[model samples]
Target: MRIGSAASLDELFDLVLEAAHEAVGYESASLMTVDPAGDALTVRASRPGRLVGTRVPVGPSISWQTLERREPIIIEGPADKALGTTYTKDVPFSICLPMMVAAKTHGVLNVNRTAHPGSDVPLFLRILADQAAFAIERMELYGDLQHFTGQLLSQDEEHRRRLARDLHDGLAPILVSAHAQLQSAGVENEQVDKATALLRRAIRETREILGTVRPATLDDLGLVAAISAAAREMATESGWTLEEALDDPGPLSREAESTLYRVAVEALNNVKKHAAAHEVRLALLKNEDTLEIDVADDGHGFETEQWGEAGVRPGHFGLLGMRERVAFLGGLCKVQSKPGEGTTVRIVVPRDRLR
Candidate 1:
């Protein structure tokens, strides 16, 4: 609590990191902040002789997993292969917790010890982390309010512009031509058939546009139904096999449902636009604690190190948007890819956010 009351974030982090080491009695500790583009986490502070100011891709580490899942993780005994290879430490225990506020994770707090921390240690650290997270969130919320609003407005406008352009250039002409054909000397059977086909095509296009804007099925049926509907269409268009394994997801707040739906749409769009795979699988699972959405594709992947870096291809705005949307709901989004392997985008939002 004392650390959280600092006047500035730098002061707060310095005190918080110190508390993680001294008060928590960890041999080593570090603090990292998520990058603005949401592709990387940069070490902001660490114990002596450890890497500071180092930026790494968000994966294969407990800290990243905590950030990706927005939950606290404690590992005992030998670490899993993914966790063992992440950082060069001979420690026997580690604790990672997400610094979250209002569903958004601002950063991660990581601590390591040579042996298991006592029962009280975990509770103490958890309480400390929560307090610290709340403080940082309060600071960030006040600091970034204007900037966040501006970003939201800008993205919304861009989305509106795209929709307007599609309607004006694509759908309007079809509808107008159909109307003209109907008004012309269309007493002949051939003219009538042509007019009917044009009108049908126009109606389909209109529905497609509306679906993209806001799927009617989402409100009428629910998220699973809406996702299945969109995925089926994508599969037919791309000639890729789409598999689904959706458990009973139950109900969610409108914002949560819409955000998840948008993320699924973006993931599938990426598969269609970039992945040359023949198969894709999407799964939605509801467990006791959280809801997870996974989109996996068997397509050629790209190097994670090179992602969002300079000289990369330009069309990653979809990914940026997906991350932002998920983060807004206090969720974590992770994209994993390898060169000849495939890519998987997983989003995990806590069930507490559900209505």
Candidate 2:
């Protein structure tokens, strides 16, 4: 297997070791991962298997020197003096290759043999170590990206919650109180009546804004009820026949619930705005270990390829936003549409991740 094709760090390490063994036919080999502090190396994968998890400090050793110099070190004859008695003392020859890429050292790969393999073996081992290093670096960078995305989504949700709370607890109540006072005064003037009507309208609009920011039904009732309420409201406004088959997904983490709810609402909004169809269907179901949300509209759909083009097009931002939101939760969002045909937006998330 190519080191670059490795899906995980562990798999990469194993592949690197296997490649080294195949290149030189070493009697024993070990792959060690550098700790975060760069102060020690731990044997993550070894041909003998028993050496796995063994930790060695990065002192004045050949492995440490190789990592520091970012080069390969070859030791011929007995390595008892170079490598401590605890490691490869009786091996007649050995090579330590630094696994490094972009000036960052990831670990060291060591191969030991009972006799000298040949001068050319070190070159092959160096190339293998370089590939392994690049793969390891890529995996670490991807992990960092995932972590950053999670944090960004969490912060965005918190901001939305705060804004919704202020509108509900601060602005909405003031409008309600003003309207109540006007009604209680029983003013018998045209101006007073108009003022009361305006206040009532303001209060209603404020509540709508609050709901749009963050729906209380999601927190009070659950995801299913919130989605059902949203779909019904959209259908009523759009004069579309609404069909729902929502199965209560029990409970979910706040983040999971919010992500799914937002995606569903976005899909519905797209249908209301773009899909000129007379009917729409929304379904929520549990398929074994996965939860799925489907929204379909029999509207005048466009080419689905235009959804994720280079430049922004009509409805591209919303679709991209929905996809990103679901992706952050390790879920998938798919939109299918064609001219003269309807559009279907499907989202699937792992059940375990919901918790």
lDDT of each: 0.75, 0.80
User: Across residues 24-140, which tens digit of lDDT does each residue of candidate 2 receive?
Assistant: 788889999899987899999998889999988968777887888788978876555745533434688889999888688999999988867587888888888888887888789
Candidate 1 lDDT: 0.75
Each prediction's TM-score versus the true structure: 0.41, 0.45
| Model 2, position 138: C-alpha lDDT score | 70
> Which parts of model 2 are misplaced by more than 4 Å?
80-88, 155-355
Q: Could you tell me the lDDT of residue 214 within candidate 1?
A: 48
Q: Local error of candidate 1 at 10, Å?
A: 40
Error of 1 at 112 (Å): 72
Question: Alpha-carbon error at 275 in model 2, in Å?
Answer: 34
Best by TM-score: 2
Candidate 1's C-alpha runs over 4 A off are 1-213, 308-315
Q: Give the lowest summed-lDDT range of ten residues in model 2.
A: 307-316
